[model samples]
Target: MAFDYKNSPTDKTFMEFDRIAAEMGDIRLVSKKELIFIPSMLQEGEQVLAFTCGVMKGKRWLVTLTDMRIIFLNKGFIFGLKQIVVDLNNVNAASGETTMFSGRISFQDGAIIHTLESVWLKTVLPFSNKLRDVIELRRGMKEEKKTFSVEGDDFVSKIERLASLTEKGFLTPEEFEMQKAKLLRE
Candidate 1:
């Protein structure tokens, strides 16, 4: 069967892929076949942010980072295609290490550890760092949301507590009013 080009990467996307590969010291490191297939894997409105090629378990693979997740793709000579996906939210503690000629990128996803090896040192270090930064940012934003929700609950509880104190006569009405005003100011 002839391959369809309907969902293929456009010139701009190709440029982006090229740019990412260039950062790894070779503009052609990512094969055209891999680039052509990338768009088909993306969800609607999802975008490829960065990608690079590396080895995993002794096989060459295309490692892609999209707006939503990381995609690991390997096209085999005889067996067709393979893919591994990890959502951004599930990624934690990404780290990279480089030796003289190559490097490794590893990250934790839940209980599993995923590692990409034999990648270019220049690319692996920055890519791992960027991945860590993104995960940390998302975690920070999530924590902020939780804090805001808790603060909302706390504010309401403070008002209720002040009203309860007033009703029990432990705090005079005037004292309750002052506390309410103080809470509101806070």
Candidate 2:
């Protein structure tokens, strides 16, 4: 069942939604009310990947993983909505622990740690593993972009970037020197 939201989904969003349903098991762990409300909180172009209903600080929350970030959503009895968001780029690590019946998932970003407890044990491993994998993939892509940033720069600028990359250990000294010589010859 599709929930109504502010914007219509694009083809990319539909593909991602299908992938999430196939891989993560349809997000049935959260409530129907939550399902109805979640799309409203999502930014345009953001795709929901996985989610688990859990407790934190004695309040129930629906912890959701999206392509762009992690969202902790709670609708209070008296109050309206309380949400905490952790950007994908800010996630330093993800870990989980499972007991006989339930599990806990924790995400550490810098000095802060966000944890959701009482998740179904079956979802713990898959969710945590996917979280870690996504973080690694995003970081890898960012590094690759950085490595190719010297493109379109002037000759002197390219050599300076190579030197900087060498200093940062992204390039070896020999590789930097070789590239510098190649650029000089051009």
Candidate 3:
């Protein structure tokens, strides 16, 4: 059956949630069974990387990190559901801090920042680290690609300069053509 967020089956447990998530795409269920509450929040092509669930200020909270986004689901009985979606591409940093009884996970995406607190430190700390690592890896790859493009532009400019020098008689046409060929090959 197709997954429905508002009309999720009550009988299905965490394992069933895993099955649903798997159906969307290849995914690693990083959160322990006890941590998952709103599995319907996950979207197609999103892979779960880490998650933690606990209580803060007498309310239950679930925070999840996925390849595509970070999700926060607040479990409230009378007030219904409140969900927050933070795109992984927008996230610049993820961090966590813990004391004896409470811990906080914070996410910063440009000018916007949000934090979630839970009483479970053991779960929060590791999840935070994993989340940060994934974000950093993504950022690094993007920066590397950007740097490569910049280098390509610089190479093209240098070739143009070489051509200009050849036109001004500073370099022979043969030498300029050879250098351009070499740069293009590299």
Q: Write the per-residue lDDT of candidate 1 for residues 1-186, one digit (tens) a residue.
A: 322224544886676667666764565576676667787888876766567778988889989877679999998865688899999989877888898999898889999998899987668766777687778888998899999999999999999998998899899999998999899898
Candidate 1, residue 152: the lDDT equals 99
lDDT of 3 by residue, 1-186 (tens): 443433555555455556633543324533443234555566754556656665545556666677778877774554566677878889988788988876787879889877677636566567777888898889898999999999988998998899899989999989998998999888
TM-score ranking of the models: 1, 2, 3
lDDT of each: 0.80, 0.78, 0.69
Deviation in Å, model 3, residue 146 alpha carbon? 2.2
Candidate 3: 10-residue stretch with minimal lDDT: 25-34
TM-score of each: 0.78, 0.71, 0.69
- Give the per-residue lDDT digits (tens) of candidate 2, residues 100-122: 98999999988998888998777
- For candidate 2, the per-residue lDDT at 14 reads 49
lDDT of 2 at 107: 91
RMSD to the hidden true structure, all candidates: 5.3, 8.1, 6.6
Models ranked on lDDT:
1, 2, 3
* lDDT assessment of candidate 2: 0.78
